[model samples]
Target: MAQLLKMENITKKFGEVTALNKISIELEAGEILSLCGENGSGKSTLMKVLCGIYPYGTYSGDIYFSNEKLTANHIKDTEDKGIAIIHQELALVKTMSVLENMFLGNEITQSVITDDNEMYLRCQTLLKQVQLDVDPHTIVGELGLGQQQLVEIAKALSKQVRLLILDEPTASLTEKETGILLNLIKDLKAHNIACIYISHKLNEVKAISDKICVIRDGEHIGTRRAEGMSEDDIITMMVGREITSLYPHEPHEIKGEVLRAENITAWHPVNTHIKRVDNASFSLHQGEILGIAGLVGSGRTELAQCLFGSYQGKSAGNIFMHGNPVKIKNCAQAIENKIVMVPEDRKKHGIIPIMGVGKNITLASLRQYCFSKQVINEPLEETIIHQSIAKLKVKTSSPELAIGRLSGGNQQKAILAKCLLLEPQVLILDEPTRGIDVGAKYEIYKLINQLAQEGMAIIVISSELPEVLGISDRVLVMHQGKIKADLINNNLTQEQVMEAALKE
Candidate 1:
């Protein structure tokens, strides 16, 4: 195999913070190299440097392509050299047709006129190569997320990409879609195109990667052949610690029902005739961790939102706390009733990015520090802010710093702290640990256990089956807007969850 790409002695710095430190990596032709790291560990930074997003002078690095020194001043400079990157956020124009999006910037030209026929032919070929069976003229917006992902790959193929860099490609995809994308990558490998696969899901990495490279805190730890390394080995290298156990499960006494939802139904916001959640009924007991496991669009998030009165659509449900009915017409009402939710999309719904960490933490429960004349008690607010930061182990220079400056894990912890400030009886965490590192996930698991020990009824909705099985006292499997099964978590496996999810 020929050497395709090599990044030597790469070091990237932002102000006083060093994002990457003497990091070195190499890729071989037709090989899939999986880059594994915690959030903010310089994996994305290193890729940005390679793809010219960081540019030459911004970072100190030497990039080589086929043993030739390469200098890319712009993204187009790298793209012209057969290197293409697909970020975690899709960069396609949704309103445009697939054919148009495929050849958006690098359009095919026939003597100064846009070559529509030639571009369409090439786009069809690219789509076929990616195994996307949709018509080239189909609008990108009408396509599902999985189909849109394939369109992104086909667009890369249109550029004759030799080295494909995929960052968290399957993060928003379903199991079936993920399988298709992985198989497409394998097919690309068969054609001798190298790939750099970055993802938090270790099982996909182990299955698809030829070699696994682990980096921690901006430095390359080591690389190993995927055949010999287990997921635990990769975790140890990434976090610089041996994690014998990922889940810290603690036994707690289950008491009477703390919260209950009966005959819950939610209608779609725009399409009033459609039901997103249908007649769902469940109960959460004191000192219990109830995990909701489902595939994408299984109505898990909708159910939680309806219960918390945060759903945008119309909802009808009977919510009971301590055997007394509560009317939660909105999120404010829900908060007043001591029911809070840490939403799944934390970046958009959980935090105020521009605000200080203290403000974000205290945003929900500001009434606690309000004085007589609609004034905030500054000294008391500061005390509560400091206490929450310390209690949640939020890593920040100060509580006054912008919440967005923190890592994903710390941001999530801060959000958890914000929800806890209200002293809620029912804590609903939706995809609580998504996009966080393994070490951060262990911490969150421990925190959930601690909360359970403290008699907080926790409802955890997650897409990761292992996480649900690992943390939950009971697992509720949902499918197609309905609760399929409620099973006790006693030696339960992922297979059982999937079986329940797939049941008719």
Candidate 2:
């Protein structure tokens, strides 16, 4: 195999933060190179530089394609050089048809008029190449996430892409969709196209990658053959130390029931005729971590939202606190009743991007620092904010810094701090460690155990089965908007949980 691309001595910095330092890597034709790193370890930054999102003069690096030095001033420049990147966040106009989106900026034209027929034919060919069975005339918004992902790849293929870059392509996809996408990548490789793959899922990386490159704290650690490297070995390299255990489980005493939900049902937000959650009932004991496991769209999130009074749909449920029925009409009522929820989409719902970390942390419990008719006591707020930041170990230069400047882990911790300020009796954490690194996940697991030890009833909704089993005292599996099984987590296997999820 011949070398297709090479990046040497790459150093990228943002203000005082060195995002990447002297990183070097190479990819061969038809090879799949997987980039493994912790959150904020510069995996995306390196790719941005490669795809010219950072441009040539903005970073110190030498990029070569086919043994010739290359410089790309814009994303189009790289695209013109047969390099295409598909971001984790798919960039497609929802209202546009699939054929239109495929030839968005790179349109086919006959003289002065746009050639819709030609573009449609090309789009059909590209879609077939990616094994997507959707019609080209279908609107992008009507397609599922997996189909939309395939459309993104078909769009990239339209550019005559020689080097394809995929960042967490399967992060939001179903297992069947993931298999289809991986198989498509194999087909692309057979056609002599190289790929640079980045993902937090080690299993997918191990299965698809020929070479694995590890980076830690903005520095290149090493690259090794994917065949011999175990997931633990990759984690060791990415975190700079061997993590003896992925889950730091600490046992705590379980007390009497703290929260009880009976006969809960929720209607779909848009489609009022359809139920998203169906008469789900569960109990959480004091000092116990209850894990909710389900497939995507299995109503786990809907059930959590209904319980927290944040679901944007009609719901009927009886919630009990200490065996007393309580009415939670909205999130404010839920919070006032000593219940708080850390929502699943942290970036969208959990934090204020432009606000300082302190303000975001205190947003939920502003009344604690209020005095004399809604006037906030600045001194008291500052004291509490500093204490919470230190307690959560949020890695930021100062509390006054923008919350968005922190890594995903720190942002999540800040949200956790926000919820903690409310001093809630029941804490609902939905996908708490979705995009966080392994080290950060361990820390979060530790924090959850500590909270349980402190007698706080915690309900964790997660897609990762390992995390559900590793941290929960009891596991509740849901399938098709209903609770399938609720089992104690002692010696429970993922196979059992998955079986419950698939069982009718």
Candidate 3:
């Protein structure tokens, strides 16, 4: 295989912080290179540099495409060279139709005029190639996260991209959708289109990659054939140490019920008849982690919101704190009752982008740590924030940094630390480790174990079957706003959970 692109001596810095440290990388024609690294380890930075987001003077590097030194002045320059990037978050206008999104900037024309028919036909064929069954005329926004993702890929493909850059593409996708995307990636390779697969999902990386390159602390660790590398070896290279086991579990025996929900049902703010959450009833016990496993659009998130009193409009639910039933109408009421929740979509709900780390960490618990009769104690607040950051092992230069500036894993840790600050009797974590790296995931599990050991009831909702089975004392599989299976999860496997999840 001939070399397609090479980035030599890439070094990037932001003020006093160095993002990339003279990292060099090479890509071959039709190759699928998996870029493995921790969050903030410069995987995304290098990809951005390749795509010209950093521009010429912003960094020191030399890029060669097809043996010709390439100039990456802007995104258009990169795209002009048959390179396209599909980001971690899908960028598509929801109001527009699939065909429109596919040929957004580069539209089709016939007889020197814009041709909608030709573009529509091409969009249909592309959708078929991607195996997405949605109609080309359908609105992109109305589609689920998984479907929207397929549309994003279709849009990128329409650009005639040769080297496709995918960043955490499966972060929001379900098992079935992830499989579809993985297959699409394989199809791209067959078409002689090389791909740069960047993700925190080691399992998917091992499954789809032809070769893997390890990057740690902004430096190139090395590259090896995917077949020859073990997950342990890759993890060690990325984090600079061996992480033998990913899941860190603690034995917790439930002593008493900490939270109880009965006949919980909620409707959409506009669509009342649309049952977002059905008559769901569940319980969380002290010193136990109860995991909720379900696919996207299965009402798992809605249920968590309803319980947290974050749901708008009429929500009929009987929430009990330690067997004592109480009514929750807002976030304040829920917090007062010692019930706290971290939402599923961190970008959409969890972290405030403009808010500083210390402020976001203390957002939930501000009421409790008040000093001098309702006036917030700045000194005490600082002390708490520092303690939380250290206790969580959050990798940040200072607590004053914006929460958005941190890596996905570190942002998640900040959110977890916020929940801990609330000191809730029950913790509702929805997709707690979603889009985060493996090392961060183990830390989250450790945090959960520590909380449970101290008699805190933890309810975890996740799409990963192995994660649910590994962390929870009992697994509650939800399907279509209803509990499908409530298993003890002792000696349970991913196959068993999937069997139960798919069970009618």
Candidate 4:
């Protein structure tokens, strides 16, 4: 029960903005401390300061590890001291094998020769510790997101880490995968390996942490024993306000059918014989929010991609707008027909990372701001960009800031703004609230309801059944590339949806 790590008076700044303000934290051996906050809050910043990603002198903080003053100038320095960080985005090289990624920088060597056999044996042992039953020779890219996550942990174990830092580890994982990860952390705890767990999933935090720390903006709110803190208490401390409802539902009239699909089928891009989406058909009505519920690999996302014309695979379907059949061969054609989607993987497909927030928001509808000879009206474009930022409530210091620098929640909102610029008749959102905190999720749900109220035909695909039940007027349960049931959301329960999805 000795103190393993302590960070005191941590303060970091970017030019003029103070990212962390006199924050302090302490963790003991075998303890799990959950860091809770909204997007852009100082949780990650504080961790970065601790792990030496921000470097020693760049931030004013005193770190004590093993009751000794620790001033680490690089991430390597911390890694050498038994501290390892696994970011939300996995840092594995996809083209490489699992063993290669595990021993990427620090390979076992003997007499100026790389010791592959020694490393392979160690890799197998680490994988066994994490319960990831994959071959060491398997390509990291070929593994599922859940398994890849476990690989990251196994890699950390190979580093001989004593204090581990995990950032949004379950953001992209399935429910079963998340369960496995939670259990693995408990196992690690039993072995006296301390951990700092950062996630927006309050239920997981409540279930896992020994202590909970809340940070707001750049300052420390407080840290308390996890035993007595409810998710509501954590929310109040993090957002500095009371959130009465997690899902804000407003009554809105559902109008006539605006779009319909018939015999929609999609084939896997690489394995052409496999059907990613099979003969899925549904109708979307104006001012109605439709929710698609399914587990991972159930083909919900493939169906949305097929509708948006962004599916990489071969697809066949009849898409009708206002009862008239239309052809959407590509994303451009889909956009031209006034149907747009905010994709599931925001970091990959949603926004241009290197581009400014303004440019990314206007990228989808730049034609509207162009004049003769494709010359853009800078004044008009800037005006609309500012307006979109305001409308979406995107928290950026300036629109010219790179969209990549924004937090996950703000990045998501910016992407939503970008899609809205197209002024689509039908909007499809896939996993819209993934990796974002509860407060930001509430804002997103409110916006979705508002859009539905404004007579837009909306489709929402989500892994969380509670989210599907909370906002949708109707729910479509898909299992094994088929839409099993379509039911009106009249006081529907999660059990009902799961039963439908699992029905034979």
Candidate 5:
């Protein structure tokens, strides 16, 4: 195999902070290289440099493509050199057709007249190459997340890409969808196209990559053959220490019921007739962790939303606090009733991106920091923000930094800090560790245990059965908006939870 690309002495800095050190890497045709690191470990930064998102003059790096000196001033320049990147957030316009998105910018033009027929034919071929059996004219918004991901890949293929960069591609994909994507990458490899795969999932990394490169804090740790590294080894390299256990579960006493939902039913936001959550009844006890386990769209999230009073659609249920029924028609009402939730989509619902981390942490409890109707106690607010950040161990250079600039794990921690500021009796976490790294996951799990120990009733919702089983004192399995089973998590297995979820 010929050398496809080389990045030598890559170094990037922001202000006085060095984001990427003198890091270097190489890739050959048809080879798959997986970049392993904790969140904010410079994987995305390196890719941005390669794709010219940082541009040539901004970063000190020598890129060689096809044995030629490659200096791209922008993404378009890199795309012309057969380089493409698929971001974690799918870039396709949801309302447009697959064919339109495929040839969005690089359309096949016939004398400046739009050639839909030619684009349609090429789009079909590209979809075929990716083994996606979807019509080119199909609306992208109508497709599932997995299918949308494939469309993004098919769109990349249409660009005649020789090298592809996938960033957290499977973060939002289902298990089956992820399998299809992994197989698709292998198929791409067979076509002699090189790939740079970046993900927090070590299992997938080991299964797919020809070699694995680990980086930490802007420095290259090492690059080794994927077959030679275990998940633990990769983790150790990435975090600079061996994580013997992924779940740091601690003993916490379970007490009497703190919150209960009886006959809960939630309607779809748009389709009023469609019930997203149906007659879901459950109880959460103080000093106990309750895990909701279900497949995507199984209504676990809807149930949490209903509990938090954030469900967009109408919901009917009897929520009791200490056996007294309480009315919670809105998020403010829920918060006032001592029930708060850390939302599933952190970026969308949890944090204010442009706001400072301190401001985001204090956003929910700002009233407590106000001295009067016209004034805010800035010193008091600052003190509380610092305390919350420290308590959550939210890694940030300063509380004034924009929360969006932080890593996924740090952002999640900041959100947790925000929720903790409210001092709610019953706390709900939806997909709390979805996109975080293993090290960060352990910390979150530990924090959950601590919260439970402090006599806080907690409800956790997760798609990963291992996570649900690992942390929950009790597990509730839901299927198609219905609670199928409530089982104690004593020596529970994934098979048992999955079986309950699929059971009629």
Candidate 6:
């Protein structure tokens, strides 16, 4: 294998924001390089520069490929050079068939017309190379998140991509799915196709990457070989400091059952046999953190959705608050019942990107400050917004700022504040500290500890095994839409829980 791509002294700026500052990296043939950074820390800008989205002269950089200095004038020119980026948001069209999505914009056609059969056959061959086991004709939207991820890999495989870039490839995948994806990456490297994987999941980086590059505040810290480094060491390198503790899970003695899910079952929107959730029942205690661990499609997110009344229709479940049952049909009813859920897909369900921080924070709690005529009160809304911003430690210019303008960590904090506005007895955080920096993660952990200390029954569903192990009093492992094992903290290890998660 040879040095396939080299980026030298990459410097990019967007108005007042310097997205990248003198960043440099290399991607060798048949090896994976992982870029580690917080959300706003220059990784995307560097990638854009390479892929020609930033173009030449827009950024101060030189991209060399195949031993030639190249100027990528546009996205097409970059693709023509055999470089492809699989975005954090998987760029698969949901309603389209797998083959259609794979062949989109570059469909296989006969000398006379479009040849879909040829396309299907090609898609099948490519999908198998990536170890996907679904029909090429299957609609991508019908598949689970993990399956959709496989489809994304297949789509990338359609082209002769020499340097494939993937961002947060396993953010929504289960542990099993993540394993499969990592294997696929290894396979790609075996073919001498270099890869650049960007993620905040340090464990995955340690497992798959040959070298790890740390970027902070839009500057390259350094790149180190991944062969010898502890998780703490990587965290220190990425954040340029030692975090004595990743999570301050100070045990708060449980008082009583504050929230309970009794006989919960959520059906799939189309297929019925594979119930998204199957007879799932769990209880959250006051002043304690409950962790739900599962493979992808184990119904963790579905169960949270069902509890929050965000499920499609006819969810068979009963939620009890302080031992009294309640029916929550929608988000409003769930808020009325003092049950708040921070969804796993934060960008899709949790935060409003275009809305201001103040408005988004006060979105779910306007009833508490309604005027005499039942209209939302402006002064009261401002007061609540400021209080939430301060309480959550959200750093921004002001509450009037757009939520997207903040870092991923601060935006997560904003969502935490929004949930707190309802004074929820039970707080459901689904992958809450994802895609953020370690310092931000510790701050969030401290906040969760404080919430637990305040007697708030908290249910945390995360894909990171270490995080779940660190924070939970009790861990529930789910497989195939059922709770496989509910184990106490003292009785669990990463291996044991992973074994339970892989149960047949």
Expressed as tens digits, the lDDT of each residue in 248-354 for candidate 5 is 78888999999999999999989899999999999989999999998888999999988888988899989999999999888999999999999989999999899
| lDDT of candidates 1 onward, in order | 0.92, 0.93, 0.87, 0.94, 0.93, 0.86
Model 3 per-residue lDDT tens digits across residues 58-163 = 9987999889898788998988888999898788988999888898888887777889888988999889888899899999888988898888888878888889
Best by lDDT: 4
What tens-digit string does per-residue lDDT give for candidate 6 at 6-33? 8899988878878788888887898899
User: RMSD in Å for candidate 3, one decimal?
Assistant: 2.2
Better model by lDDT: candidate 4 vs candidate 6: 4
Question: What are the models' TM-scores?
Answer: 0.96, 0.97, 0.94, 0.98, 0.97, 0.90
Show model 4 residue runs off by greater than 4 Å.
none
RMSD of 2: 1.4
State which candidate, 3 or 4, has the greater lDDT. 4
Overall local distance difference test of candidate 1: 0.92
Flag regions of model 2 displaced more than 4 Å: none
Q: Which stretches of candidate 1 lie over 4 Å from their true place?
A: none
Each candidate: RMSD: 1.7, 1.4, 2.2, 1.3, 1.4, 2.8
Better of 1 and 4 by TM-score: 4
* lDDT tens digits by residue: candidate 2, 1-504: 999999999999999889899999999999999999988899999999999999999999899988888898999999998999999889999999999999999999999799989998999999999999989999999999899999999999999999999998987788889999999999999999999999888999999999999999899999999999999999999888898888888878999998999999999888888888999999999999999998988999999988888999899979999999999989999998889999988989999989999999999888889896579999999999999999998888888899988888999999999999999999999999977777888889999999999999999998888889989999999998899999999889999999999987
